[model samples]
Target: MNPLIRPRRLRTTPAMRRLVAETRIHPAQLILPLFVREGLTAPAPIEAMPGVVQHSLDSLKAATADAAAAGIGGVMLFGIPSTRDAIGSAATDADGILNRATRAVAAEVGDALVVQTDLCLDEFTDHGHCGVLDARGLVDNDATLERYRDMAVAQAEAGSALLGLSGMMDGQVAAVRDALDAAGRTDTAILAYAAKYASAFYGPFREAVDSQLTGDRRTYQQDPANRIEGLREAGLDEAEGADVLMVKPAMSYLDVLADVAATAQVPVWAYQVSGEYAMIEAAARNGWIDRDRAIRESVTGILRAGAGAVLTYWALELAAEGRV
Candidate 1:
């Protein structure tokens, strides 16, 4: 045994492990992702995502207030529109559910928490694509960027401090940034989903958003196999003025998260996406795991992987329970 490299010595006691911990998870380092469905007078439970609900306007306000009170960093809002269209018009409409939800959260939390909104169209589009399709029914990348410009302005006007560009479209961050600047919203920040991969872990998210995705997102989202490509995407986003770079499905891609965090100058974030959350909940319900311990460990793993912050459904609960 190497006496000088005795890692067990540090792990021998709880206080010793805490003192030697290289990473720390705090309530302020977690951002809650909430879904608000339009025309819902009461909260609706997402069947696939147990314990999560699609909030109405009033419920959303109360939830945001509670999140702020619990010392969580922020809320990332997603909207389930009352109607869907080919072009996802609702995503760019000022009165759209997402933008309106942003305003609601902003009004409730104000400057107390950083309010962010999902700047993607999957939840609002009839085809359930992140972008509008062309004549051939394929996602048109350039066309999507144009739509993103409109979306950025709408979200900014709705009082979203940060826009989470989760569409994985080419030139999206730069296009949105230019549009925001042109609209005199230079203060608004862009959080690029720089290394988002097309993963099965997003199944629960589709349920949460009432998505109508007919096919896979492989055309736009990154492939799970390529680490170098993830770095390339993060670099492009950074050059395009993204304030933050994110790796999606954090648990399965911690290596990618760490790689992006190491390479990017901007803050790197990770999304503990819906499927990840559901897995934990499902296992806990089946009595296969200790729920609280699993939640803490999952979040702790994300923080230890070099994420600057994590977007999780458990944000408010974690804060309320003082687990973070």
Candidate 2:
């Protein structure tokens, strides 16, 4: 090695490093995930997640408009129903909170930003599972696909530009795609939660949605130990016509995100879930870290790991701060 060829030369200053940075985060590369709860008169703060809120219908509309104004690429909407049942009948109702919110947001934004909806039953189901349960109380994959089919049509009719298939069911992408095409919704896109893991990091999310899941999601969500399985799932989703592939709990699964990005023909996304956001907030509150820099570093790390886009609770704040 030549002494004259020091690598630290590029790291000598912020401007020098900025000039040679390989990855950059942009507002368009951020997707905000919003929770819309039925029966809420106003926005309700999620205590577990400091800055995030469960928005009422009117608040959801305003939030989507703010997201559009912030120049974020999209917003992923998750619905929290007032009542829940075994089959989640509310999910397929056009008048349900999610569908209604979709229509409202779409009307407000009008293609200025992509309006997407979470295509899952967990929030609507009293059992708090992603799929309909069987006699054995296990998730029925094929049965859930049928529900997803109905949900796809419902979301399409409600003006969801992209459907977030997050239930982790087999053949979901194909089933939903066929349903959308059959309904003459060829313009709608699918965002596959291809590598979502069964993670402890989702604890705050359960609180955010008021989930009552008694058991675990190990049967459907990928195990954190199984990196190869994640890639396999991504491949399957891609083969089934997923327009975008995503890895969940992004901070811990940067490896998964990077691998998926490398192999996926479509755009690869990552979800910075609730626990990730809460941890950062908790630390920043105690002054354990620099809040602003930590936030940027956390998201920038995900981007550098190869996510084309990231779904983060911090999207709005980051956009306002011009960090993304």
Candidate 3:
């Protein structure tokens, strides 16, 4: 007697499974997110996210070289300034940590990979809001756009190939685009963080950046419960000249990612945020999960859900292991 349907035929061997795989992860599809702190003689390790560090400028150059050697598509830089103010003055300072880091990394690997910069005020603001606060203590939206314009030009002038606009402010894409063009940085691209959610998954990132936040960003970041809103935000950014759109906290928001990827005119990407990395590392350390398999599976799942590329802390490690 013969069974009419034997689906196991496709799963019979490793070679068969590999040949039938619908999704694959590649080094060129990974973008590494790196942090560099001002005035550090040595790299400072971030406690919440194991194995991730805030690099000194020198160390940042070394690391960026390694990323380029690994064949990753790009590196996204975040700076931790020694000083911050209500308007995040340091963000637009040409000699600020982030800008200096961008220059160094671009010089080191700009010819080999895309050098990107985080274009947000959260890391540079004394209040830790993504934008300036109004007199009544609310984040002023229109006012923030003005600041973003300055930041766009600064980051572009510093040699960032792509400006990651992760502040989630209204009209940010348009403002930044116009700023870049006016500054004659017509080649600088915008990576709009279109659907960054107000989620607990960003907890570890605060530690990484030494965040000065006293309150949640619920007023600006998209609510975690809204999937359709992600699409709407992405659409607005796309129409406003965004070269790429990003959905943050990738794993929990696969539905939003897939939705955005389905119709976006430009490429769609996902950020496997700090909390997701910490969780996997924590579980692996506890012997509850196979670390390598988990990493591969997690990223594969993101790609399967339609992310054209992924920004992950694991990019280097995965590339080193030849897993991507």
Candidate 4:
């Protein structure tokens, strides 16, 4: 049978496919997620995440400089403090590891790239929860909001251009927005983790941040079973003045990402989280797949699913490859 319309014509050449690509990824649209552990003298490789590392302050600056040079969008910084507490006091201290790293990065490449910090207590809290627990040993929502408010101001003061609010607490976006506005840091922006799911896929991330968690965050993070609730959460964050909305563990939540991206008035981004990254890297190392091809295809799928940008560990590598 002869078809009048032929889709194979467009697939004939690489250039033709490139020219017709509906979802193209630019280097400037890729945000790299970085981790810096306090007091480290050198970069330490993360075992589960193979090529990724926990950088020292000096290494962090060097890495950020490299990222800026690569022309990638930005770097999202996560700090592993030398100390932890019940209330995550260091998260609000100007001299804290995260804050200090933020200041250094901004000084090094603020003019070239967006400097973002993880505005969550999980890494700083001894309890391994995103928020402080009450006397009953359960997460205290309102108390957590209070802590987030303080953390927002601190991150802004430390020169973070965007605060990645990953603590999925209720009213978090509003609380942080109000706090930032009141502090006269009106220029700082919030990237709400609007639809972060409580998935087992975050297992490698726990190791990356040295998470002290004994249990899980299923109480706060969205359940994987609910799709409509993702839209609801994204809408709430947007209504609360989120400058950007993100869906985490992106590959597993493409439906949620698409839904949010379709309706979000603000930029919608996705996180290619630690577990997702580990799966590909591990598989590739075992010769089951082409490493480079898998990396490109995975990100392309995420972008095609409707993410305006992606926070990935491969931002630098992709940017250097000159095509993604």
Candidate 5:
């Protein structure tokens, strides 16, 4: 029998480590989430998220073109509209910012990268909850499903390859799916935010989307304390015909992600949310960590945990660096 077992032998060089790496990142595996604001002549920077911006329509086309050239998988678009109402009437408008942005990106990229839209009302609603709040100020699930059915048709007509079902309303995936099919958009797909949590990690994203939420969304979003609940959500979405399933704030919810990934039959994805991106960027700016290595390490962990794809803010930059 051999006496010495030096695992260190494989760890001796960068080439050696690379040769045996179990998990890897690729440019085509990353999806860049982009923000498009209405009526902006120029792009505006988000202070909470360094190096990210709310793109004007022109700037959005440029960003989409850049993402296409870099061989990235896709761009997930979130719109910051100019107005909102209690019922979010603008959400179903054909010429609304989101639909306009979706059409613009589809025309710009032209299948070079997948064009996905956030199919939720939070960005459109004046109160900024995922759904319409009743007279009691509680979110109305059935009412919201009707709204999503309308929004689904709008996004599909605008050329979204996938609608991100992030609203967490009851029966959302089935609702959106039926709506799309009835509208004759049998090709439009869904990416369900199966295990989205009520986490503080979404703070930067609220600012990014111009959210008007005055209170917590704990009623609809999954509790951070519950693990089995994530699987339940996943199972429901899959049964409802979700083409993809995702876990948000992935760095903190790798366990939830892992469970969903293990049980899911479709492609599984994870989102390294805005706060997770901001934290890393902030520390890197302060020289507290090696930025390049940290980005790779963080995503590698998520990938190893069973995510086939990751939505990250660094998609473009990582692709440019040829790190994949």
Candidate 6:
């Protein structure tokens, strides 16, 4: 006989495995990401992301209702404006697509689910940069902060409970926080994309938002080469009063997510971005993997990596089947 206790005893039965499971994923810990295209009468398919569509306003309402009924923690809304400009003026407009969508979701779901909006300019800007550019064609961080300040106020006014600050601009959280306080929108929380990296995983996202980005966001978004830098960014966002900090492209950056989760005093979340979803869908469609099992395993991995919540496109589907 072996000198040590046999570890295989824990795997003897399904009940024993369940008892020893180290991580759990709940429907309440999942958030659904939705895109609403302005001026569209019907939802449009995003070819890059199979089974996902750019929803019209009416469809968006139905989706939000479904998410709320599924007991999802929240919904993060992104808008595809009918027009674009250098400064992304639509982002702050009261009649802007995102603001309108925010109102719709808030009215549809109310306190049943947290209503969150993507507070980024890329979807609204013609050049597709997260911030306004300077004379030298580089992203101006301070200029972007100013825009974010206004965007924060507009989203809060439109009834968003939380603002997802996806733009990786310097001092963005503090700037937005200050603006929210000044505008008497202290109730609106900020979910900062603190450790967001410049990853290729956003390809599907571009199509989902109908992005017209002419250039990359590397000038502002963090480089993928450094892990320590992720921790530093998370610390900065935490210090600036971020209610929650997030790491984008969850599967690829589980290490960074773990580090951020370990040190951050605030809630830590992970975005299972478009590319990750598309890959699984593609493989499943080709019969290379089990779609349902893949979704659960991927989400479970993120949870085991210490993500308090995950933003996944599969939220509604999983919840509908009671698999979350």
- The lDDT per prediction is 0.91, 0.93, 0.95, 0.95, 0.94, 0.92
lDDT of 5 by residue, 1-324 (tens): 885987889999999999999888898999999999999999999999999999999999999999999999999999989999998888899999999999989999957999999999999999999999999999999999999999999999999999999989989999999999998999999999999999999999999999999999999998999999999999999999999999997999999999998889999999999999999999999999999999989989999999998999999887886587
Model 6 segments more than 4 A misplaced = 2-4
lDDT, model 1, position 252: 88
Task: Report model 3's TM-score to 2 decimal places.
Answer: 0.99
lDDT of 4 by residue, 52-146 (tens): 99999999999999999999999999999999999999999999999999999999999999999999999999999999999988999999999
Q: Every model's Cα RMSD, please?
A: 1.5, 1.3, 0.9, 0.8, 1.2, 1.2
Taking all chains together, each candidate's TM-score versus the true structure is 0.96, 0.97, 0.99, 0.99, 0.98, 0.97
- Candidates 4 and 5, the one with greater TM-score: 4
Candidate 2 Cα deviation (angstroms), residue 124 = 0.4
Task: Report the C-alpha lDDT of model 6 over 198-271, residue by residue, as the tens digit.
Answer: 99999989889878887688877889988999999999999999999999989999999999999989999999
Candidate 5 local Cα displacement, residue 75, angstroms = 0.3
**Candidate 1 per-residue C-alpha lDDT over 1-324 given as tens digits, one digit per residue, 9 for 90 to 100:** 657776688899888988988777788999999999999999999988898999999999998888888998989999999999999999888888888888878888978899999998888899999998999999999998999999999999999999999999989999999999999999999999999999999998888888898879999898899888998999999999999999998998999888888778889999999899999999999999999889889999998988989999988877876454
By summed lDDT, the worst window of 10 consecutive residues in model 6 runs over 315-324
User: Candidate 4 clashing pairs?
Assistant: none
> What TM-score number comes out for model 5?
0.98
55-99: candidate 3 lDDT, tens digit per residue: 999999999999999999999999999999999999999999999
Candidate 3 achieves a global lDDT of: 0.95
State the lDDT of candidate 2 residue by residue for 1-324, as single tens digits. 669778998999988988998888789999999999999999999999998999999988888889999999999999999989999998999999999999999999957998889999999999999999999999999999999999999999999999999999999999999999999999999999999999999999998889978999999998899999999999999999999999998999999898999989999999999999999999999999999999899999999999999999888888886464
Q: What value does the lDDT take at residue 241 in candidate 5?
A: 98
Clash counts for the predictions, in order:
0, 0, 0, 0, 0, 0
Write down the worst ten-residue block by lDDT for model 4. 315-324
